[model samples]
Target chain A: MSQFENVSVVKQANVYFDGKCISHSVQFADGTKKSVGVVLPATLTFNTGVPETMECVAGACRYKLKDGDWQSSRAGESFSIPGNSSFDIEVVGEPYHYVCHFG
Target chain B: MSQFENVSVVKQANVYFDGKCISHSVQFADGTKKSVGVVLPATLTFNTGVPETMECVAGACRYKLKDGDWQSSRAGESFSIPGNSSFDIEVVGEPYHYVCHFG
Candidate 1:
């Protein structure tokens, strides 16, 4: 039940991969932005525009960075992706919940 | 783009109906709670313990409240459901984005 307090959140969701992934953008008072999102049980590839740190809030995901081996990240775990790069993520059984930090 | 300011948002999403509908809980400074959510293209039934007002933020939905006729609610429109009641919503084409106010 971790939450982001005293922040601004966009009402509309960002739906990707035909709704397999959905996220809401939140902005802090200091102008930092992050996304709280979920990836349904599916394997998907995502391209990053800026550097991002994906923190698992609940559930789990197995991710593979560009030219890297697959690694599992569960609740309380995290993985980073370089800007202008891409990654593949596979979620099974349950949804993958995450907080994505942008830089 | 409409946004909620100075609020707390739950990091984990509320996934319902096998991920057909997803929402994030948001709490205001005064303790009021709402959910920003999206319903994918599907027909789903939802039961409520408390009264709720569903405000469409994007896309559209045709809803039937209990024994009422099906009605359309698009962006900027809202529909209310009585406490201890159930409603059926059908979304087609694009995902239906909404803000659900509970009381």
Candidate 2:
């Protein structure tokens, strides 16, 4: 996917996950929150409070939706995870650059 | 700083610094490159080819311009690095969150 254009950023925040990942949160004018983060070569499970759309800005990863099959996403690719559910993401070698949008 | 704001992202890129820092590069609609990144708790020096204005998005870090004073900047703060010069950034407790503007 391309960059997010014409976005009004309101606030920024940092998220820590021990030494696994650190995501920088971006809050926009329309009350939407997005995070640009890097996930190292590890497998992680994330629980979302809101529906999230994750875009692979760089690198690649594999994911399995709740009770679904594992799929892969590369640079400029995207996937959607339903809110209140969880998904598993696994990465290898290169740390993945991701842009996550919550709605 | 709170968030970035209305931004049109044309492309997303990843920047690496060995293991010290990893930044996700956001290329905006007007051709500006802004990186939202995390600096591990280490002192690293960077050389810039263009004038850079760095905003502290989260945590804090100490920096000194070329032959300048060493100063600390917390979240919601910012510093500028001149073109063709270098700056030293030191982080101790927390990884510093930064938004760097390049011109």
Candidate 3:
């Protein structure tokens, strides 16, 4: 069996976003990496009016919806965004680390 | 939302296991608690000959199988145990935190 066959631990890494926070990449811990960029950070919102799923691993943030409703999340919190909509967010403190999976 | 809606963060709590090392409980973070004890820790082993699923949240431990092959796990690691078997474990460091779900 592979070294990871019985392992479920995934390490976290940092990414550099240049003003535009939209990009995608397949990160592997085994020294191999793949790049896939087709989304925009500004256009990719969640928990407010965006169609996406976001999980917060650290820090906090506020998501403002198009209809004026807002949601807040802190470290260890997760939120689900409905499809066919968009939203905005402001980092509450420090740089936030989130995992976003989109369709 | 009932404060738990849209939140995926689960807080960890300490469990006091007697020398027997076997107990069951449904732990909730919302001030509610449930207790279920029907399994023996000595008979509920994993990754070796135990048919149980185990997750390591903190510290490290080693599982020595009956066949002499052993498995080790550190913090943040998780492993699945096959069904109908049992194994033994030895904590390597400080008290370890693990979550076991059985059928």
Candidate 4:
């Protein structure tokens, strides 16, 4: 821990998905909030009340925006999800790493 | 830059899997060799001439040894493969994060 003696910021996790995914909710010094999560392969659905931007940081995934078609998204690809709606994700062959921004 | 004022360590990557996974090869102050790789869902093979202790840091995976059964590995789990042999990894429904320690 002393290696990071100068780093006062420690990442904290707020949610865990059976080790398949982990969400670390970060609150910046100015109190802005963002969540970074690592998602493994699987078909999972999420309901949101706040608009969110999901950024694929590592792997790939196909997401269906409510009644929308499943679109292909690769690493570094991103999509937006509306508030009061839900989205479905089909994790592809590899782990799908992502960061979600919410307001 | 000033955020990690106490952290002198900077992660460097020697391999990148199309941004699906990234490996940060860490060389300790004592000259130890280890590779930390985040693997997105994929079926990949690796050949190693040195012994490695593959530790799952985040996700899960199934690895098959030489003529061995496909064993399930989850988060915080690990398996060792002999030197000079190759192994197959079928990344399941998530990212397979790993830390490989070598001599």
- TM-score of model 4 (CA atoms): 0.47
Ranking by lDDT: 1, 2, 4, 3
In model 3, where do residues sit more than 4 Å from their true spots?
A1-24, A27-50, B1-103
In DockQ terms, which candidate is top?
Answer: 1
- In order, the first chain's TM-score in every candidate is 0.98, 0.85, 0.53, 0.81
State fnat for each of the candidate structures.
0.95, 0.55, 0.00, 0.21
Model 1's alpha-carbon lDDT is: 0.98
Query: Clashing residue pairs in candidate 3, if any?
Result: A22-A41, A49-A86, B49-B86, B50-B85, B50-B86, B51-B82, B51-B85
Model 1 chain A poorest ten-residue lDDT run: A1-10
Among these predicted structures, which one has the highest TM-score? 1
Model 3 agreement with the true structure over A12-51: per-residue lDDT tens digits: 1112232223222333345333222111223234333335
In the range A1-103, model 2's lDDT, one tens digit per residue, is 4555566543343444543566656655666767777777789999989999998878899999999999999988899999999999998888777888887
Which should have the higher TM-score, number 2 or number 4? 2
DockQ of each: 0.96, 0.45, 0.01, 0.13
lDDT tens per residue, model 4, A22-98? 55443444555555566666788889889999977667888999989989887667899999999988886667766
Q: Candidate 2, which CAPRI tier?
A: acceptable
Q: Comparing candidate 1 with candidate 4, which one achieves the higher TM-score?
A: 1
Per-model tally of clashing residue pairs: 0, 23, 7, 11
Docking class of 1: high
User: Candidate 3: deviation at residue B5, Å?
Assistant: 35
Worst 10 residues of 1 chain B by lDDT: B1-10
**Using DockQ as the measure, what is the rank order of every candidate, best first?**
1, 2, 4, 3
